[model samples]
Target chain A: MSQRVPVHVEVNGRGYDREVEPRRTLADFLREDLGLKGTHVACEHGFCGNCNVLLDGAAIRSCLMFAVQAGGRSVETVESLAGSDGELDELQLAFTEHHALQCGFCTPAMLLTAKQFLRENPGVTDARRIREAINGVICRCTGYQQIVAAIAAVAQAQQTAHSIRIETAPPVRVAQDTR
Target chain B: MLAGGQSLVQLLKFRRCRPSALVDINGIPGLDAIERRDGELHVGALVRQQALLDDPQVAESWPLLREAAGFVGYPETRRRGTLAGSLAFAAPWAELTAAAVALDAQLDICSAAGQRSLAAREFFRGPGETALGDGELIVAVRFPAPAPGTGAAFHEVSVRHRDYAQVAAAAQVSPDGHGELVLLCVAPTPHRVDVSEALTRDDAIADLLGRLDPLDDVEASASYRQRVAPVLARRALRDAAERAHRRAPA
Candidate 1:
């Protein structure tokens, strides 16, 4: 038998220590051990993003990685996206507004993916580009057009606000202090 | 594990490959560089397809390569798919291997022994096979710097953008220099055509046609693939030449 290794990891900002088999996948640890059922496992394989989570800030498929490999890593799931007050994020609101989901099985992964994408591309103006970026995600319900629209709306709104600030914000006086 | 798992995991589910153990190489450090040194571009093995699609260096220096990367799988798959694993497998129908072969790229590989380099043409052996020795791993791939006036293009036809390529082709043309054209996914390895002689002729396409012998498969007939190869090759050549012309001094 291979030796069991001890791993310490932080999930949703909470740390935990566990001794586990070297072969155990991170997805199993997340769902079976931690009981964070929000991270679904549709394809145990990597095609479906249902098992996706943010690993050290980048989106990765948890099912394809081993628990030992993720040792000492910071992981975030869909469950961590909400505020303590249980308020839905702008992306969640947009998803609901556009009816981007039907079965809801793929929603958690979709939302998490879009969240990461939006952060990297803070202010994109083109809807076509957004649609193309999200094209790999499969929605059996064929509700993708709306999802793209919702994300684009949020991005456009952010861009417009940024441009307004650039145009209207006042400049500092010559006596501006640098301390 | 299995690096990207974009195509591998799907194959596992379909019973195509069932390894008892899958080593995850994504977490491996220093496997995602896209640096240019001297006169070659070195792309780290684990670099994601999505990263290639949006890389400024790739976009400006090799637009056709970027466009080819964009056409692979889909957004989610691209986010996880690694260039090394895709080529290492070299399945009969992989578009990446075809593109690499067409571009005359060099593969940098690592194994228990040490590091070795193989030209793309020699790396691919047969369907689902490669020249990779056991315990060896691909570290990166290198592409030669584009000449003063060079252009390249990659194109493929599939049931969908994300589907396995039914027919794929890539071409590179150098002004007043040698040209390389290849067809992908039509056989075990990407088929390269030595167009040095035909390229000098006025009707290069007609001459190039005489040298090609396409394979027959269910997705597309061998005859059709053979016929389509020339058309795609011609288009790729024309596009490359035009691009080169635009970059030339007035």
Candidate 2:
């Protein structure tokens, strides 16, 4: 038996300090140890995106990263994407409204990836770019058109909201300097 | 152990691999750098494919390498897979080997004994095998200063956009503006076809074709890969030449 190593991690807005084997993967830790089953495990390999999670705001394959490796880091799963009041976020709502999921095997990873992709590529409302960004995750149940639609819907809404914010906010005059 | 696991993990799920233990090297610092020193380029072993493609230095300086990195897989796999892992592992059929061979790159390997450097010609021994002995780790790879006015290109045929290459070829034209050719994936290892003598003959293609013994395999027949090898080689040579000419200082 491998020796149990102590690990401190922040998951889904909660801090966890526990002892686990050095060999325990972060995916297994999230699902089995903490009981945050939102992060699915499929294929066990990195090929399937079911084990995808955000490690310090970057999407990565959790199975390939060991739990001990995630020590002293903030790890976010699909569960954190929910609203603070426990309601679905706009992307989750868009997914449901568009019927973007069927078996839901790849939903958590897909949602997490799509969430980060949209935030980074703000105002890139093109359907082709959305497909290219989410191409990292693998989905066999849905044909992927509806998922793309959900992401597009969210991007369009964010753009509109940003425009409104710009229009409503107070503006300050700036002085130009000639050097 | 290589932590990227793009190819190794797939083999594990299929029960084709079962290593006694895996040493995670992803956390190891200073192994993912892309450095340029004294006109030579060095890419660290753990440098990810995505990072390699995104670096402007790599893109502008080594366009052929950039294109090869983009063809590895989708964004996710590229985010973790390393250049040294692919070269050290070789992974049966790989396009990077062909590119490295065409570019005359050097492999910097470090083991308990010491550090040694081997040219790509000597590093790649055969399919799915390399010159690296047990307990040794690939530290970095170095590319020689490209000849002035030389260009290079990499081409492969695959079923899907991201699938492994069925038959990949990389070629570079000489800087002297004379016709010179280097062929990859033409043998068990990436072998260069010596076309110097043949190029001086009337039918250069015919002379080169007569001296080939391409092996048959599951991905592609030896003869078929052999036949298409020169076609892609010719195209790569032309493309690389054009790129070199465009970048050469007047």
Candidate 3:
């Protein structure tokens, strides 16, 4: 049997074609083949919650998934959480401002997990719920308080920004007949 | 065949499930559907653990499952773990087994040869074991319709929120006033105990711990399981019974 299998996939909106072994995990694929080192792996097992990335927009353990399994699917890594021009997204900014990470090992997974959580639950304002939603992203250094605060701050900002857009709507200029 | 890679991939990485070739089943259409069919909710093979808890219809129709779903792996794990996959893996520590036992669920499986049905209780034989034959795969699980006045409660004691429970308890009260109590992670597999007057009596709840000798593992001791099993059983039964009463009709 051939050792390597062909795979075509999209990562962070860019398409790529690559060959991977049947047993090669997606984590190894991104970090090694694609040079997307932003996604880190700590436990290698699924328990540690590092190595997390969005597959077809849902967060999953890349360490537990083979690159062949991700064939034809779109993956969004921790690197995708940053803006196109290299600016950090809102959650990333909040994590930086709040000092949500100390060692920075779990930050990539944390950001992707929090990004999905925030996007899925934009209307949710409960700090406790936000903490629970991101519970899977384990942070050994932050003690979780500041991390929760960071996510909560972003959620609050989103809510405030939404209300501001609603309250500051421009007056409707009715279309008039131009003779 | 791989449905959820949560367990299978880990096993593969550890040189456990080195099946010559893995048939990825994620592309099977309509396998992800969680729907109500003929008064019973059919949970397809690809239904994620997170979806069972997140769906309002499922949460309302099957509280036993909804509550138990929370005690499974972490959110990230559940985001990929499937109910059918858990049952197929047949891990005793799995929350789905206890819920299936309490809910009296049925398993539907198929192979290139044919199709067949098995009771959830009979499907599980031991840890990492099931009645599934070679070339066969679980297709879907059927949960009984919610009967009036029925309520459920689940409780588990774990070292951490996301870690598997050293011992877990799930109790379901039928509308007719009988309750099925299931205990997990203590034996080779989760088994149901016939608790007489389970909803009202403390003796029956405590008797749940007497059904088996706990297995000692890295997370807990046998003696600890013996002591804590009853406490979790009592809480589960009490909450289920009380809620069942509130939901019961005149």
Candidate 4:
């Protein structure tokens, strides 16, 4: 006898409802059941981060979580990075510009991992700190120099944009407005 | 329940652990809280490792736990892995296991019958084992916050910074040189050794490493652990004591 567990998850701005076995992993559910192949599974163990995804905006190893655990939560896969108009996000654009991928097997996880890193750390510019942020997402292709450069480029641009926004904004003359 | 699938899901995928059902404990409330109450730091079963690392109090008050979380796994894995799950698994080299043992943490458990508690030192029976019985679920892990003049540090030797440590050591130093030294990945469990008196004779401490009977495995040679456990222990002791001295102002 077997039991089926029901899960309602929002994946990449889309909601999905399914009844999966309690044993099916989030990686398997993402790739097999939902057919979102962007989440690649390698080394099925937690050692390799090929199956990394974002659970509630935090990077998590998809292979290490069951789908039932993801119930009522929002899951963002590598597929979520690109927009519906087929445009790349800032980090994706930087990845392409820096030649971050060679074989591209680890690209999906690299993208999601770097995305979450940049999100959690908004103004991080130190090279060592950037390296530590993405240390878990291993890429045998580009030797990590390009990957580090890609994520750093986005963070740098974000910092620049943030400072510019503060400097260029119009000053408010009415300091106190009580409604 | 899905305490943290970092290790459990992998075991399921490889057909290593075939449990009849999973409880999916994420739906439960209050199991993910990390708070201080009754003079103890309570870490719920679902409290992820990142939460502990991010807490300012845990960082300043119990920095050894934060240090151990950094070495547990990759950044993504840490986002989902939980402390109680790691302690329940009781991997010999697990960072939090050594931290729990060194801190003398207490584990709170619950079942259909009600609730109970166990000491960290008494929890782990062997590799991949704990004292938790059937129907009993680890509700939270309570750590006695290090007292005034207390300092602690965790150190490990691994091929890569993120790999499972070959040998791990954690030391909590208090005033008057009474400290607790625990070593991991060297024996069948997180081995806690009272270093209160041992600190008086620093030169003879190397002989104490022989009690662990370090294991041989693919990660490293048995000789490597034997050689490194004491070295790491000495390093931890020095740092821990130095930190303790910092806490006790002149």
lDDT of each: 0.76, 0.77, 0.86, 0.85
lDDT of 3 by residue, A1-179 (tens): 35888999899999989988877889999999999999999889898888889998888899988898888999999888777799988888999999999999999888888888888887566878977877777788888888888988898998998899889999889999999
lDDT of 1 by residue, B153-224 (tens): 777777665667666767666666567777775555788877776556646775665745555777777777
B144-170 per-residue lDDT for model 2 (tens digits): 756655566677776555565666666
| Range of the 10 consecutive residues with the lowest summed lDDT in candidate 4 chain B | B203-212
- Model 4, span A19-128: residue lDDT tens: 99877889999999999999998888887788989989888888888787788899999888888899998988999999989999999988988888788788787889
- Model 3 chain B, poorest ten-residue lDDT window? B204-213
- Give the per-residue lDDT of model 2 (tens digit) for A12-68: 879999899976889999999999999998877776677888888778888877788
Residue pairs with backbone overlap in model 1: A136-B75, B1-B24
TM-score of every prediction relative to native = 0.85, 0.86, 0.94, 0.94
Q: What C-alpha lDDT, on a 0 to 100 scale, does residue A67 get in candidate 3? A: 90
> What DockQ does every candidate get?
0.39, 0.45, 0.72, 0.77
lDDT of candidate 4 over B94-194, digit per residue (tens): 89998998888999999999999999989999989889998899999999988767877788888987788899889878867888899987788887876
Clashes in model 2: which pairs? B151-B240, B152-B240, B215-B222, B216-B222
Question: What CAPRI class is candidate 2?
Answer: acceptable
Tens digits of lDDT, candidate 1, A36-138: 9998888787766678788887777888777776788899898898898999888888888888888888778778777777888888847777766565456
TM-score of chain A of 1: 0.87
DockQ of 1: 0.39
